[model samples]
Target: MKTRLGCLSNKSDSCSDFSEFLPPAQETAARSLKLSTDEAEQWSESFDVLLSHKYGLSAFRAFLKTEFSDENIEFWTACEEYKKIKSSAKLVSKANKIYKEFIDVQAPREVNIDYRTREKTRRCLEDPSPTSLNEVQAKIYSLMEKDSYPRFLRSKMYQDIINRTHAKCQRRSV
Candidate 1:
C-alpha cells in the first residue's frame, strides 16, 4: 500500500527511495522558495525557528524523506493540524485516524516512539482533546531537532537552496 505524504508522490514504497520523483511543477516551486541568507541564518538557529516558515518546513521535509524518517515529521504535522479541529466530532475521528496511521504497531507509516508514549497516546482515545498527542508530538519534534536538524543544516540539499537563493538575490540587485 502506498503511503501519502501530502502532495508528494512517488512509485517507491518508502520515502527513502532516493529517486527524484517530485512533479516538475512542485520542484520548480520548491526551488523558487529558495532560502535567503537571512533565512538560512534563522534556520540554523534552531529547529522551531526554521519550522516557523513554510519554505523551511518544506525543505526540511524533503531532507527527512532522504533519511527515511519523513514519517516523524509527517506525524508531527498531522498532530499540529489535528489540534485545530474545533468540532468535537471531527476531533475524535481525526485523532483516532492519526493514532492508527502513525502510532499503531501495524501502521504502514508508524513513527518511532517508546511503548510508554504509544500507550499514553492510546489512552487519549478514551477522551480525545486537542492536546491528545502533545507528548508524542514533542518527542518527535525533539528527535528531529536534535538529530536531523543539525544534519540538515550541513546537507547538500540545504546548501543548494542557500546558494540558489543567494544567486537570485544577487541577480535582483544587479
Candidate 2:
C-alpha cells in the first residue's frame, strides 16, 4: 500500500514513492514508523528530540518539503554522512560531492546559507578535513532549529499526525 510518506531522498522534487526501492529490512523499518501519541507529543520537547526520532524526522522532512526548504535538512543529513567516512579517499570524494550537490553556489540542491558561511565552507573544501562542513552544518542546524522547527510544530501536518497517533492509541485502549 502506498503511503503519503514519499520523497525519502535529499532531492525532493525528483522523488517518487521510492520506499519501494528500500531493502526488505529497511522497507519494513520504514513501514514500521508507527509513532505512539506520547512519542508524537515528545516531538515538541526539543528540536534535537524531534530529529532523534525516526518517525519525527520523517514527518519533519515531509513538512520541510511542503515549505520548499527540504534542502536544508538534506544538506544537514549529507554533512552527517560525509563526517562518517573512515577512508581518506572516500572522505575527499564525499566532501566534493556534497559541495557540488548542496554547497556550491547554484548547486542542484543548494541549501540556504549566507555568503560568509558559504565561503567558509568552500574554503574548508580545499583542506578537506573531516570537520570541514561542521560550521556550515551547524549554521543550517541553527536555521532549522530556530525557524523551520518552530513552524513544523505548528504545521497542520504535525497536528494531523498527533491526532492520528492519539486516535490510534485511544482505539487500542478501547
TM-score for each predicted model, relative to the true structure = 0.79, 0.84
lDDT of 1 at 27: 57
lDDT of 1 at 44: 82
- Top TM-score prediction, candidate number: 2
- What are the per-residue Cα lDDT tens digits for candidate 1 across 1-174? 122232234232222221223444565454433345677667888888888876677668778888888898889889999999999999999988998899999898899889999998899877999998899999999988889999999987666656655655777699
Score each candidate by Cα lDDT.
0.74, 0.77
In model 1, the runs with Cα more than 4 Å from the true position are: 1-35
Quality of model 1 by C-alpha lDDT: 0.74
- For candidate 2, the per-residue lDDT at 153 reads 90
Worst 10 residues of 2 by lDDT: 9-18
Clashes of 1: 0
